[model samples]
Target: MEVVVNRQDRRKRRLVRLFLRLLLISLVFAAACAVGLLSYTKMQGPPPLNVTQTTVYYGADQSIIGEHHQGENRHWLPISSIDTEVIEATLAVEDRKFYSHFGFDPTRIGAAVLANLKTGSKSQGASTITQQYARNLYLSHDKTWKRKWNELLYSLRLEMNYDKDQILEGYLNTVYYGHGAYGIEAAAQHYFGKTAEQLNLAEASMLAGIPKGPSYYSPLFDLERAKKRQGVVLQSMVATGYLNQIEADEAHLEELTFVQNELDQPSTIGPYFQDTVEKELIQTIGIDQALFEAGGLKIYTTLDPQMQKEAEKWVASEMPDSELQTALVAIDPRTGDVKALVGGKDYTESPYNRATEAKRQPGSSFKPFLYYAALENGYTAATTLLSEETTFTIDEGRGSWSPSNFNDNYADDFITLLQATAFSDNIYAVKTHLLLGTDKLVEVAERVGVESKLKNHPSLALGTSGVSPFEMARAYSAFANGGKRVEPRLIRKIVDSEGEVLFEAEPEMTQVLDPKLAFIMTDLMTGMFDPYLNAHTSVTGGSVSHLVSRPIAGKSGSTSSDSWMVGFTPQLVTSVWVGYDKGNLQKPAEGQIAKRIWAQFTEGALKGQLKKEFPVPAGVVGVKMNPENGLLATEDCPTHRVSYFVEGTEPTKPCPPPAADGQPETEVIDEATKEKENLINRLFRWLGN
Candidate 1:
């Protein structure tokens, strides 16, 4: 019996020795791992604390214009900026041993581990403020072992690198409160309509209790529950020696005025413009969407607040309150910076940004592109095409397309290019389009910053291609800027939260057009406002000409469903479009509204600005010519006007001496001659096809 008992004791002692040896090995392995992790973390330096802060957008003058966040309205505040009561309450509830412990409280952790084991779940948490902040910054709040292990390493690294105050401040700044509020500063503002520094003891305690379960403890979510949480916080503060019993009781009894209605959010000056900036940052500028939303970027945009207000104001007042939607965009001709933009009459009802998204046929507004091509292809402002009813041959003469002038009106005679453009003579424009191959116009459109896809259709000259107002403005900016490529830019610079410049815009320009040809086209566009250029039809811009107090060059275009007015000066380019959504037919009465809005906005936006003229480039000469014929003006001509021309393109001959009769001689076309001319035009059309 004694020998059997000795054997049992010996077996028990051996089992105990084996357990001790294994435990010692495990301790050594864990210590080595901890030391290696610490060394690695130390070499890595401090972890970034700028997690998920609110991105602020500023206008040209550096005034706040907009803000964005990743569903959490986080705003960072220093520990000094935070209220004393808030810190005390947070420390009392979150980590009483915060200053004394390294990064975690082992006593509380041991107790929590036992409790979690008993519950068979991670229902009990003992994270100190430092550990919580580390998790908030780097790891997700999953109760899994992997996340917890990562949290432990991160927390240790933080404690080694930063002081206690830094961890506390970072925690206060990044901890999430409810209702889209992420930090204590945002929380104080959200709940009390005051800043974190202005928080009273009552408000501080209320805010400090929110991090436990933001949705459940938010006063906005439930006042009674929040008050109970606040009471617990006050009692904890008292127990932690941060508050006396009397003070705690007084704070608990104090009546707090929660913000009734959300503090009137400062209205963003231009919502559509803001959206475009965000888009350019992500899509065109190649910024990651996650970083753009959560990186706390300081976006400095080119928007002029006053100009934006005027744009919205004029659009609202001038636009008739109907289902007809409108889009307006204004840009600086020189810098290519978008100054103001309105996507639609109401953004809430529809977030579709028509300024940048809607692709409507620009109608006659597209003629400028064709005209520019003509100038490039040996056609001058003095060039003439017979404006008569004509049918054009297409596809090797397999089909015919007949184009008519507005109101079926026609000069039925030779008219100068200036007159053709001023009158918007469709017959003349079509003849010119076919004369210059369709590819020329498409090439010109692309070079001048029209990004929309253009097809080589004969009707493209009459503005059959769909383009957005934003593209139209950019295209016209080249003309206004003397032939330099103008890429629309909304954000001038972007900075990260740490004051590092993420991106900065440099004024880049490529000479895309002959400076002389661009200047001449700009000069020709002004003919739309000149009554002297009127022949069969009124000048396209004549209705709004009287509204111009300065030398403003502009054009108006209309399709069955869309209306557009694009205009510019040396300083600014503005484009306005009015139309029904989804291409519904627009009423004739609404046609003039686009012009009115353009004129009013242009005049308003440039009201106090200097009147600048388009600088005529070298190698161009001005000559007085007969408005009726593209000939040097003589004493017999009824009207004379100065026309700018490339030095050699001016007509060498004066108008033919007046006939024996006092009136000028008119070309008399006999029937045979007319038929022969018609056959010749058809032959050219066939050849072009």
Candidate 2:
């Protein structure tokens, strides 16, 4: 009886000691947790919620051009906006106890530790939804105790500051889904071409499986692997009581039709122009590459969405053949706005951006600048220039310079400067360039906004030097807007998310020529359109001449390799180019391709707008001159034509009377003329032999 009593006493005492020991352990754990909570609470509020949003671009008409998300490819959604199925699937797979836990899930962490110990590697992860968000937000993915500790602290702070719904929504939006998608919305859009609110059970389960191993089971990379992972996610949903076995099985077995991602598709709008906007955005906001992409900037551009669409449509519909390429750029003359720009037929096929980057010879389109320089000098629209086949024996030992007209036949000796332009006479242009020094023409070109290097050689007048369509448009803008150069602008302003104007563009203009002289140049260009004026070729009155309704002036340029039609009205300036990316355009096709494109674009873009006439600036006077001679017109002169002349430049002398037989006088031939005649005779003789 005494031994039994002693044994009972010892058992009771041992039980009491065991209870005390457990109590002590609980107290110590509580103290450690309290210390951790305190430390986390003082951790500077999680380094400022660096949530990245998509930067939106707006056109001049306030329509959304595009949205670009830096590296995340994420679009944020509130918990209320997400589908119930997606939320349930996410809870089942990522954190079943998401609503119950504070920030760290002790049970999950303990299980992860035991699993990791068995594998002798930290491959097993136990981060809850909140903990994962903390890791993604503040800590790096490096597997180390320090990183884990920081993640834990950040998680605790998140729980303290935000509600359960807030934490879960942020986690769902921030976690990575495969194929460069982030957030539930981005994942849904990427996988099923829908929003998070539109996702069904089958798609939700599939997306729920991705954040665990995004690249490992990416649908784009491994479809079978992704399916298997999706099955795992569906089973988890069943086990977690969110779904029944039959429901989970049906969802798992349902054939998933993954719609294509919109980001992967080509833009329906002006993709090339959008690309240019992004490039300019990069230059505008000189920040870290990551920040620039993540800046969530609101960019307002000068693009006219309507004009851009039309330009792209015409370029594609007009130039269907892929062998030949085309680029068209349009600008508002008064504002320097790039209203329409198309670099190629289809941006997806090739995004080389020929409008801004391709440099080819401007051909005869460059003749306007030569005339502008001529007018700035002593020349006038009534000034006569000889457009005959002539040679300059500039260097007897080395070589001689001889310029030929487009047609083998030379013009009358007394063709006025305006008529010379009408026929696109190369001889007349070269003669004018020589009269006004070659260096003077180069200066005029630079002042008119030819950013590319120009040549001072005699061939420069023939546009042997290369220039981009952008340069061509801006240079022509001088004539369009009264002799002032307006720098072409892609973006007008940039604003931040807070409605703060971060940057604004001011119009950069410089007066390069006399307004009257520029108007006279415009007058000379108009002759290229009137068949009566340009009996040789009226590019405007050609097959596509019906497209132009208002008064407009332009030049058609062509070479063995490049073709161009750069034109402008008083309000708009546009330049069009056609050629192979490299090598000569050897195919024998229509010569009017460039002219036709210009006519179509001008007619379409100017539709529905008020007709604007080119205002003749002051100090410009009109005079009726004989097309045969640069003299005041009389009834006796043959084919009298009206010409614009700068006030002081018009001739005061009246034209001489016609010969009694109404025929021209025979003139003595000089050595240069005789040499040209001999060269022509020898060419015919060689052909005959």
Candidate 3:
């Protein structure tokens, strides 16, 4: 009886312990359920509050061009705005069980786990479309259990709060489709130059497959891989009953044709321009936290589609096969608007945008401002200066620095100020800088849009100072716009998604130089290209004559390794630079590419515009001068020989007759001499007066 009682007591104790353990387990599970429910309730409280101001772009005519978002890194359209077929196709291929799942599909998850186990590796995702949306909207793509749990929980909450259409809309807007594209709208426009509403089934399936891994399936990168993925998506659609087998097969077999409109196509647009605008946009509009998290943005840019296309073609064709790169920046001088910009040969290969980012020595391009400074300081075009070889020693406390012209020759023999400038005589420019004072020249450069740090050294006259193409273009606009400096602008105006103006570029034009001085500088630059004035003309007569209708002025520049040409017509100012990425010296073959590109682009860009010569200001006047000597000339002087002068600064005395010896010689009276002498005296007096 005692033994039986002990056995029963032990059994009762064991049963009691087991019951306690079961109760504890139940309580823990209930607590977990309560916590999950609380989390779900928090997530379902509201769609993340976001304020995305769509950027509104305007055409040159001020017409509405396009719109972009801040969050999605691309343009976004409402789910209702897209075609129902597009939505169906996306769901059919990406997540057929999308509408029926609670964010996570148990059956798919089991199958994925089994596949992983069998393959001894993970190869599939169990998250439904709603789960992807949730991950995009709220959770990160971290491959951690914690992130996965959060994704699953938020996805379920999303499904509960939103209908299938709403979930689909959010997913479409938030998914990344590579190439810096965020959502379907951007992807559609980026790849096919169309909207989601216009995509055919084949295109739709191709785009849908991209979300799985954009880089891996990018048609631009690998068409074959993209086609294979697209085929899989088509098969999935058929299997999911979204398409009949025959229809699916036909769609798969159809040629994948992507039409890229100049404006919407990513290939045609300037990648560097896009990068620049994006940087500027980031500063203008703060990235909205919600939209950024959600991932689609409609970015309306200031790029002119036609101009960009032309520029891209010019670079690809004109740029040499060498590693040397080229950059171009074109702007409307009147408004300081950037009309077109090409950063490099290929953005994928190199993201460095030489247009605004790279700082290269401007070479002789810096001479213009020095000349302008000379004009401002009361130096006239006929101002005589010795271009003979000379040297200067810098009183650096420890050592002396001497500068020499590229030609290693001096104008000491006698070269007119105009001739010295025309030839880009390095010695003459340095001497001019010394006479005018380095500080004053630096000040003028700063006023005319040189933002780079300039030293007070004489070498600065030779463009030893580093500067960007954008700055150089802006500076040249002072000459283009008649002395007014227009700050370079990338964005014309910014509007929200609702078409409300968030910001607009109010161009600030400041008179950086006297109109008279600007005209004199332009005149001097024009003479620089005249073969009659410059012994070594950098441009041909055909090129110079082309600028005659419009008062065009330009300066060609060459540094040790970089070549530059900054010039302007009455309407536009363009700057082009060519150099190696490593700042190495360009071979002769590579250097000429920049000049060729500039000539080609300018010819095409000015096709329809009327030839308008640069407007000559009232104080400016032209006078005939001896080509060899910048002095008042007689009828005997070359008719093509001319120099610019401020009315008061014209030559007051006639050039003396050429001397045969150290002493001045008298003219021999002959029939030819008598007639020519009288004509020469009268012409000189008229020019002097």
TM-score of each: 0.75, 0.77, 0.68
lDDT per residue, candidate 2, 493-544, as tens digits? 8887557787788778888888988988988887788776654444333455
Question: Lowest-scoring 10 consecutive residues by lDDT in candidate 3?
Answer: 536-545
lDDT for model 3: 0.72
**Highest-scoring model, lDDT:** 1
Residue lDDT tens for model 1, 542-584 = 8888886888887788888999999998989999999999766
Listed per candidate, the RMSD to the true structure in angstroms reads 7.7, 8.3, 9.4
C-alpha lDDT of all candidate models, in order: 0.85, 0.80, 0.72
Off by over 4 Å in 3: 1-44, 47-75, 84-165, 171-193, 199-268, 282-295, 305-325, 343-346, 393-412, 494-502, 534-551, 580-593, 638-642, 652-689
Ranking by TM-score: 2, 1, 3
